[model samples]
Target chain A: GGIITQTPKFLIGQEGQKLTLKCQQNFNHDTMYWYRQDSGKGLRLIYYSITENDLQKGDLSEGYDASREKKSSFSLTVTSAQKNEMAVFLCASSIGLANSDYTFGSGTRLLVI
Target chain B: LAKTTQPPSMEAYEGQEVNVSCSHTNIATSEYIYWYRQVPHQGPQFIIQGYKDYVVNEVASLFISADRKLSTLSLPWVSLRDAAVYYCIVTDRTGGLSGKLTFGEGTQVTVIS
Candidate 1:
């Protein structure tokens, strides 16, 4: 079994501040993704990486940046935190191109004041 | 990507079977149905996926209709741990970073004693 670890489970930031969340996976997966979950709304994809250093933007990519520093790690940065953007950010990884092999991290809950 | 619709919430008792249904009226022939669940304060967890017919694993069973416009996830003998938001997603066969999922509000299954 492998684990996807997300650092600093809770994050608090002021409006207009820049915040970054980190994710690391030991599954040796080939694809990684970042998703934001609002209270009533479901998850929306922010960004994803096919491999190390390869990035792809999703429907909700604006105001957010992602980097796959290495095959085992992917990071997401909020360019400017806003109260409306405060939500739980989830990191997930899948083996190769298979969707059924997706494994997720605990998540980073962000709170912007 | 095919849009999905699910119930806003559902209630089930412990040891009872729970069947969550999803509708995708415009699902393409090349798309597949996927199921995921999210417990409070945690990332969404992939439960199952199917192309057509029926697919079953240790955790759940997926039943897809003939037209592939509808699917159901059946969990037998559900417990309190099963209480969570269940998501159904539809997407094409393409994988990698290009195959990001679009999630809906999902069905919140509350398992009561």
Candidate 2:
């Protein structure tokens, strides 16, 4: 009965350029997450927020920055795009970890040249 | 985060039941097994999850062994739309607030007519 919306279905950036992806969830979930998926690979966590103004670093948060300015929105910024990089970034939200009630948004496909 | 292992690929025919197994030899006591599917150009969708024994939902069923070391997700009456990459994950669900999801190389399931 809820939906997560991600902006910019496709992104094209130049090498060393800064790119950003945004996500909005109307599920009123308490936790939000960002994951990146490379070709033929699994999803990797980038960052997460348990509540508004709370940020946590994930395994692959090195070159990324995240913000939870509002409970309904979470944003991810790529510090510097790598050349020839292509990947899909997903946004997900959940009420709690107790059950697997996680919901995801259509991902943003990023391509750097 | 307990690591998960699943087949790289699988195939099934329409109207057939497809079962994908996952192995988590070192799963912890408080961990849970979750299954998600990702259609091309879409975000991953939650299918089912189980802590122990068997759990069923409208879309799929999750079966866990007594030892909790292995689990299976069964999707009945498969169709062409069922073709996608399936991911099995193990995570701690204590306090109803698990951190981020750790994904592995999922199983690419192909449903043929």
Please give the C-alpha DockQ score of model 2: 0.67
Off by over 4 Å in 2: A97-99, B95-99
Residue B75 error, candidate 2, Å: 1.1
* Candidate 2 structure, TM-score to reference: 0.95
Single out the weakest 10-residue window by summed lDDT for candidate 2 chain A: A94-103
Q: What's the number of clashes in each of the models? A: 0, 0
* i-RMSD per candidate, Å: 2.1, 2.5
Candidate 1: Cα lDDT at B17 = 100
Candidate 1 residue-wise lDDT, B1-113, digit = tens: 44898989999999999999999999888788889999998888889999999999999999999999899999999999999999999887577543567788999999999
TM-score of chain B of each: 0.94, 0.93
**Candidate 1 has which clashing residue pairs, if any?**
none
